[model samples]
Target: MAKFFGNLNAVLVGGLAVLIVIMFGLHSAVLGESIYPNQLFRYLHVLCGIMWIGLLYYLNFVQVPTMPSMPDELKPAISGHIAPRVLFWFRWAAAFTVLTGLIVAHLSGYLVEALTFQPGVVLIGIGMWMALIMAFNVWFIIWPAQKKILGIVEASADEKAAAAPRALIASRTNTLLSIPMLYCMVTQNALGV
Candidate 1:
């Protein structure tokens, strides 16, 4: 048990298997059959968004802020190991979050409603577009820059150094956008657009 738990892939797979088994035995054979596909998709979108934004906050609020004061030797662990791995999750989470969110709107038959700037759905559209832009920046701008900065692939020292600030700025923009994005997503519905 301990050995199985010690391996990340094994633990993740094992835990998911346990969860599925429990859900099947305790309740319905298919867990999500009760909800509309859009509802399920939205729920999953929120889940992925949490991971994406949670890591974003970790990078911006915790890691980057602390890095400058750390010893140079310790810094490489962050730049090389921790960052590359965290970003793998971060960027992919952003991508799925956006993709599923769009699909959810489509599934709900709101894809046109949301995008067409109908008075009722426009606010939600704003939040969706915000998320889309941030995810785009995450996958296209930040990840590429971070690849260089984190040394996941070889780059000249100067190239690495150059990528660092550009990545940070893109991250900062996401942080700024995230605040209003959250507000619009929640209140957009509650407040009647």
Candidate 2:
């Protein structure tokens, strides 16, 4: 339904449904061996990370850059409506991505190896740590500050003003860290993790 798709919960439910389908496909006969839950966890982590980072790029690369030029009336649609919705997805995706990533690493017998940055695990470990830090920033620093700045929840005028720069800095920091993190993720695998 139009109204259903328009809502955040609906969109999330849709993603979850897709995840379930992927798990089913992984188990289907034609796929050969059944994939472990840890393998599935890795897929979940990648999926959520994509959602979170993709939106972050959109906000920084497109929306924020364009906001000042837009009319005040148009601004509300973005700041008050669209941004809040996107951020809900952003923050939760960050949390779940981190959660699922850790679970996968542990289940796959890579956690300690990765954390210690053992020879074969170092690159991905770096990526994992970077992701953990980014997730922390998303949940603790950016989202809370954004709630005030975006007027999604009431805040004092002073608080609102303060929140904007704080949120921007945290988001930007995440962007910076993401580059190295992703490189390490790819390199680890490419190097035969």
lDDT of 1 at 84: 83
Tens-place lDDT digits, model 1, residues 39-69: 6688789999999999999999999999989
Instruction: Give each model's whole-structure lDDT.
Output: 0.86, 0.85
Per-residue lDDT tens digits for candidate 2, residues 43-88, read 7888988998898898889987899899988998898789988999
- Candidate 2 clashes between residue pairs 3 or more apart in a chain or in different chains: none
TM match of model 1 to true structure: 0.85
TM-score per candidate, in order? 0.85, 0.83
Candidate 1: the clashing residue pairs are none
- RMSD of every candidate to native, in Å, equals 2.7, 3.5
lDDT of 2: 0.85
